[model samples]
Target chain A: MTTALTVETDPAQLCCEPSSQPVLNAVDAQESARVLKALSDPNRLRLLSIVKAGDGGEACVCDLTEPLDLGQPTVSHHLKILVDAGLLEREKRGTWAYYSLVPGALEAASARILGL
Target chain B: MTTALTVETDPAQLCCEPSSQPVLNAVDAQESARVLKALSDPNRLRLLSIVKAGDGGEACVCDLTEPLDLGQPTVSHHLKILVDAGLLEREKRGTWAYYSLVPGALEAASARILGL
Candidate 1:
């Protein structure tokens, strides 16, 4: 199944306004925090790194399993979390599922924090 | 007492490399995830937004309590978490503690996710 998602502005820049000013509000904080929680795990982080470093900026399930030294199910689980958090996108081709990073998810998230 | 902390790069850009490229590693995932875990909270995110939007890019304990509708101790607790996560810097100005956003922390995190 192909899930369509919206790519927001770079999170790094999106998180806050210029350094001299303040723009973050209560709602912004809660939303940003939820994004952070998604990346807070060692395995998930590793999985993301693997995916980002993969050829064509994407990795398939079978290719990811060995590098993570994790069970296929565990790797699959982490990929699901990344996908749910909007950090990664999944595309199934034939029997394999290929995962790629969401273009602006990270940037928008980081921008909120950096105010850059 | 004053605590000195190092502000890393914007999390957004720091998380990953340019698209069509992969640079994330095992270590990067673990480190970035830890950072994400720090931002994955509703209260903490709100607190961060409040701080970022404050004057002079900083806010004091007394100023934060009312906006959050949280007890002083709870606000203090959340601030501590942000500070611990390196998302903020705490400065003791007289009897009050002032909090400010850590430059680049958010960008680095977001970049990691966006691979920007």
Candidate 2:
């Protein structure tokens, strides 16, 4: 009876066999997740919005704190995360740091999610 | 010195004054982050891809585990997160549960990011 049951369990007969290969491979998934993780924070998203809406599509660290009611250090921390994630570019003009959206960064991120 | 410094500081002259309003308000940022957080996991992204490429754009929960070499419970947990984020829909057919991408859900998420 045990032998018969084992023989009857055909792999091809399984109902759950995968029908197609995933377009997003493991490596790409990890990279995509990293970008998404950086965007997972509320403050970070707000920072991106603030920067995007700023003069010339850029905003200074000093300018970010007031809108979010967050301390300079905290706001700077969030900006750094965005910079590291390749979503924002930081430029130092004089004594202040200005941040701008990396051109096409958001579009690329959106593509990653959709393409996956 | 205090009085002199105070007189020298002009709000309009500040380098950090925001030039425009953020398109993403705090409340909306929070909501967008929730969806992003759900997609931030590597496993979850892979799961989404698999479901997306599955037969008829759907796949059984049983078929999911083998691809990632993860157990059923873990896969199910990830799937639940996607469903709660409104990115995926789940249906039960007989003894198996199948998952598929929610229509326009990815596009909406992408829009949220780009619009911000």
Candidate 3:
């Protein structure tokens, strides 16, 4: 014969289990944060906007300076950061450099957060 | 009689027009950057992932610390930042605190980037 009793339970099991579902690993989190950190600036965002709206789907560095009221050097610095983050591509066209959004980068960024 | 001129254009007009389609305004950019800044930390991103995957869409503060290998105070600080950024909501049950993702905030954050 067997008897069952339910007067109490183990104290440890009362605590909720941490979800087994995949969470962001440290390496991926670091990488995603780096990209996001690059985008967490107002000027950088404005630069992306200007480049995105530029004629022929690209904008010369000269055109970017005037709109943001930033110096050419300052705008260039911001653009370089965006370029490094893989969100923008830079091209040299004779005397001036042009910048344009990397195709699908914005969508990829959006997906990063949603997929997380 | 009027003569049509096509040989050259005015010097100012040669530069592309800054986007007439309205880029992110300063206020909105500042606001969005704050939220993204909150997310730009590796620990914070992991915190969000764990909470999102927690049972019944909620998790206790006690459960969060071990998975991230962070101290309770450190985890609390990160949770506070996420809460302040409008990404998570906190509720108190007895002596412990519970956190859940703020509905639609991730979508809104993604929208902020795409809309920009």
Candidate 4:
């Protein structure tokens, strides 16, 4: 899916005025809100950071449980949410699941907040 | 208050490896989650866009109600949440409440997602 929120905008200029390019419309706003909502939890953000910090920019499900003081099931649930939200990608390896940050996912979300 | 999430990072490189810089800790994750949860609503984003698109990058509560297809109270509630999140600033002028984007608020949030 094409992420409209990924549009580039200057960090120095945060607000997008009406006189400027098109503002975030209702449809785009709703879609953006959904992904933003996915990122609204502390455990989830922690999980994302852990997975992001793993070796080779990827981590096994087994390695993620210790850092956040969460169990495997709870951690897996958070990982599932992040995966469904398009922020992460998951791969099945034997009995373990490997997770990685989807390239440009965080940047796209960042762009949406900075862009209109 | 200083915003740790506002630390700059290259957008092209989104992941934060364990061997590299510090990843988002639990405390920062919670703080970031609070602000992110604030941006998780559709109407709120629409309201933000309306305010952001207004003249001088600000808008009045009266002007905001109609375009958003919501009554004054509803719109105000959404505005309050955004304000609490430090995304919008409110000013009292006469009988109306004027709102404007807090400069770099969005960037701080955007920076957080990109940074860690």
Model 4 off-target regions past 4 Å? A1-22, B1-22
lDDT tens digits by residue: candidate 3, A1-116: 12222323533346667565438998989988988888888888877777777777788776777767878789878888899999999998766678889999888877778867
**Cα misplacement distance, residue A76 of candidate 2 (Å):** 1.3
Model 1's CAPRI class is incorrect
Ranking by DockQ: 2, 3, 4, 1
The TM-score leader among the candidates is 2
Clashes (N, CA, C under 3 Å) per candidate: 36, 0, 0, 0
How do the predictions measure up, each by TM-score? 0.71, 0.90, 0.84, 0.80
- What digit string (tens of lDDT, one per residue) describes model 4 on residues A1-116? 24545444432234322233226788999888988998999888877887777888888776677677777789888888899899999998766678999999999998888885
lDDT of 3 by residue, B21-95 (tens): 327777788898888888889999898988888887888887888887889799989999999999999999876
The collision pairs in model 2 are none
> Distance (Å) between predicted and true CA of A9, model 2?
5.8
Off by over 4 Å in 1: A1-23, B1-23, B114-116
Q: B47-103, model 2: which lDDT tens digit per residue?
A: 998888887988888788877888878988899999999999999987788899999
The deviation in Å at residue A19 for candidate 3 is 3.9
Candidate 4 global TM-score: 0.80
Q: What pairs collide in candidate 3?
A: none
The TM-scores of chain A alone, one per candidate, are 0.73, 0.86, 0.82, 0.77
In model 1, the Cα lDDT at residue A53 comes to 73
Against the true structure, what is every candidate's RMSD?
18.3, 2.7, 7.6, 15.1
